[model samples]
Target: MKENENKNEIVEIDDVDREIINLFNEDGRMSYRKIAKLLNVSIGTVHNRMEKLTKNGVIQKFTPVIDHSKLGYNLTTIIGVRVKGGVLENWEDRTAYHKNVLCMYDVTGEFDAILVARFKDTSELDQFIKSLLREPDVQRTYTQTVLNIVKEDLSSSKML
Candidate 1:
C-alpha cells in the first residue's frame, strides 16, 4: 500500500454511504431493508450502492469466523519467517494450499513474512514448519504459541 493511495483516488460519498457501511461492518448479515429503513432511503438505493461498492472492490468478501477449538484444532501459533528468492512476493501460491495457515503477510520487521496458523497437534505443526524450511527460498523462522486471542477484526473497519 502506498501512502499516496487515497490522495490519488477520489471517493466522495454522502452521509448515508458512511452509515450503511458502518452498520454492515458491525454485522454483514443485516438485511438491505433494515439498512434502507435506518438510512431513510429506498431499498433499491441501498441495493445499488452496495452493489457498486462490491463491484469496485471496496467490499472484498463476506465470510464467517469459526471456533476452531470445537473442530479439535486447539493450537494457535504466530511464525516469523525470513525467506529468499522473492518467495515473499509469491506467498499467495505458497500458502494457498495450506488449510491450516489462516493468514500470511510480507511485513516490515525482523522477519520477511509472518504467518498465523491453527493445527490439530504439534506433530502436524512440526511437519508444516519442516516443509516450509525445505523451501529453497526460506532461510529461517521463529515462532511462538498463542495462548490467548484478544481481538479479531475481519472487516477491516478502516474501509468501512
Candidate 2:
C-alpha cells in the first residue's frame, strides 16, 4: 500500500497505478518492460508499482485461470446454509476449508452463509451436501446448480 516499503501504510492510487493494474488484469504474464513501453514509463517504475501492489495486498498472487469444466469439475453449485444461532461464522469458517469449496460468504436473506463449490457430478454434490448436514450447527442447506457461467472474472481491475 505504501510506496515507501512500509506495507502497513495505505497509499492513494493514481492514474499510472490504475493503468498498470489494468495491464496486469489483461495479462498477468506481461513483462515489466512491455508494460513500461505501453505506459510510456520506465521498467523500474512498473516494477516498483507492482511491488507496492503486492506488498499492499492488491495483487494477492499471479495464478493461471483454470477452466473447471475441462478439468472434469462440470457441476457448479451454490449452497445456501441456514446455520444454528451463534454458529454462522463458525460453520462458514469450517466449511471454507473443504477442497471442493471455491469461496464462502456470510450473507443476508434466508441464509446465513453461502458456499460456491464445484463437483464432478450430482452424486459428488449430494455427498458433499450430506456431509455438511452432518456437521454440528448446520441447520439446513439449499443447493442450486449453476446452469451456465455467463461471465466470471476474479480480477479487481474492473472496480477501478
Candidate 3:
C-alpha cells in the first residue's frame, strides 16, 4: 500500500492496475476495448479497473501534453523564489494560480520555491515577476530564461 499525501490515506495499486496505468501513460486516447484485447481481459474488466483507479485518485485526469512554444508562449523561464519563513505555503498558494505559471515546486537550497512559467515575451515575464515581488511575503527572486528545451516529458511511465 502507498500513502496518498493529498488524501492522507493508504492506496494500493496491483500489478494489473500498474499495467493499465502504463498503457494509458503511453497513449491517453487508448480505448477500453483495445486495452481489454491487449490485456486479454473483458472490456468490462478494463472499464471497472480504470473506474476504480480514478475513484481511488490514482488517476487524476487525462490530459494532453501540449507544446507551449507552438501556442505562442515562447518564453519559458524558471523563477527561484525566496519567501519569508513560516509563510512559504501561503506564498506558494498565492503564486501558483497565475495563468502563466505552468508548474511550481517547494524546493530546497537557496530558494524556498521554484516556478516554471511561460510567457509570450520578456515584457510579459517582467510584469509577472514584478507583481510577485510586490507581495509582502516574497523576499527575493532569481529568474533564468530557457534558451531551448532539450527534453520535456511530463509522463513518468515512458521508462516502463
| Predictions in order: lDDT | 0.81, 0.88, 0.89
Model 3: per-residue Cα lDDT over 86-129, one tens digit each: 99988877778999999999888999999999999999999999
TM-score of each: 0.81, 0.89, 0.86
Sort every candidate by TM-score, greatest first.
2, 3, 1
Better model by lDDT, 2 or 3?
3
Candidate 3's TM-score? 0.86
* lDDT of candidate 2 over 12-116, digit per residue (tens): 788999999998888888999999999999999999999988877777789877788898999999999999998777777777999899989889899998889
Q: Between which residue pairs do clashes occur in model 3? A: none
C-alpha RMSD values across all candidates = 3.8, 3.4, 2.9
Quote the lDDT for 108 in model 1.
92
Lowest lDDT block of 10, candidate 1: 2-11
Better of 1 and 2 by lDDT: 2
Span of ten consecutive residues with least summed lDDT in model 3: 1-10
